[model samples]
Target: MIDYKPVSTPMSPKPKLSLTSGTLFDDPSKYRMVLGSLQYLSFTRPDIAYAVNKMSQFMHRPTDMHWQDAKQILRYLARTLSHGIYLRPNAPLALHAYSDADWTGDSDDMVSTNAYLIYLGSAPVSWSSKKQRGVACSSTEAEYRAVANTTAELRWLTSLLTELGVRLPTSPVVYCDNVGATYLCANLVFHSRMKHIALDYHFIREQVQSGELRVEHVSTKD
Candidate 1:
């Protein structure tokens, strides 16, 4: 696993997300090489993981259009290379996670972008940005899918901590912005409303019921 630098007290300032999306690059091979570098850099810069991963999908036959997007990530990195996870001293260390989904975010496949942000105490340690497995019938289902994915990540991390002899202080807290999904998780109800969701998703409901992961509704901005 990559060890990302953690920040606690505010240093200079949080680096702003670079606004440049993409530009024009002529060499297809160089474009592929640059993409490789950015993907490795994502070990320290998780915020850009989604954007960089999206750009890498076009590498085999990268167009001038694809090259522009790769450069855009470089520009964003240029503006925020100094940033990483900020872990403060003497603060309470707790594991908390937040999940969200962009329903049908992709116009082509109509797949949702399932992502989560996880904080170890005041600093974030783990996060993921990935495409969901199937077409969700509703926004609630999409968000629930994201929560299930994030729950798996939490379970794996906690297991690693236990193997390393690190005692976890509390049950991991998982916050989702959608309330209806929260109900879906707790109610244990089966209905046409959720028929499209895969059967494996019940894993989240089980974890929630057994108290391995606590699901709570939080403000979307958090």
Candidate 2:
């Protein structure tokens, strides 16, 4: 792809890749090799992280469509070679995060995709984009699961920073786009819809009650 035309985006928003969408790729090894390199690239180029994660799901049995998507990522890289995360030494030391979910996004399994980006002051220190373990019954459930995942990561980061002698001035806040999920965090009344995910509910509620974490609602447009 050295001389390929550049693309503005890594993956096309229209295509929803599935496990069995296209014919088998002619060269499986090549597909895996290229995707493996892209996985490494995602560490610095978070713009391509979701695309890489989506393509990586098909590594075991790559199709022609998957190969084309991978090439598109390369094209995107060519267009934005200079883009990367910049860390500022004078950035604040507080921790805050944003969590989101695409409910029933997977074409094959109907599992939701949960992602979170945690920022330590100005620079992003931790982020994740992956499918949920189980199918969520509602959009609220999916969003709550994402918030739970983000809270767990924040707890770990808090412990690690504490060990490093770094102190945060305030409790970390998790910003979620779904208002219902945010309410679930602080509301003790358990709705019947959320009973299936009781474990996750209690786990996050414990942190909030102890003043270790805070969950807030943020509009998706923000």
Winning candidate number (TM-score): 2
Runs of candidate 2 with Cα error greater than 4 angstroms are none
Q: Cα RMSD to native, each candidate?
A: 6.8, 1.3
Assess the local accuracy of residue 78 in candidate 1 as a C-alpha lDDT between 0 and 100: 60
Query: Lowest summed-lDDT stretch of 10 residues in model 2?
Result: 192-201
After superposition, the stretches of candidate 1 with alpha carbons farther than 4 Å from their true spots are: 1-26, 190-192
Q: Report the C-alpha lDDT of model 1 over 25-107, residue by residue, as the tens digit.
A: 46878978888988788777777877776666667667666665566666666666578877788657578898999887665
| Tens-digit per-residue lDDT, 1-222, candidate 2 | 889999999999777899998999999999999999988887777678788888999999999999999999999999999997888999889999999999998889999998989999988888888999989999999999999889999999999999999999999999999989998888888555578885745689889889989999999999
- Candidate that scores best on lDDT: 2
Give me the displacement of residue 208 in model 1, in angstroms.
1.2
TM-score of each: 0.81, 0.95
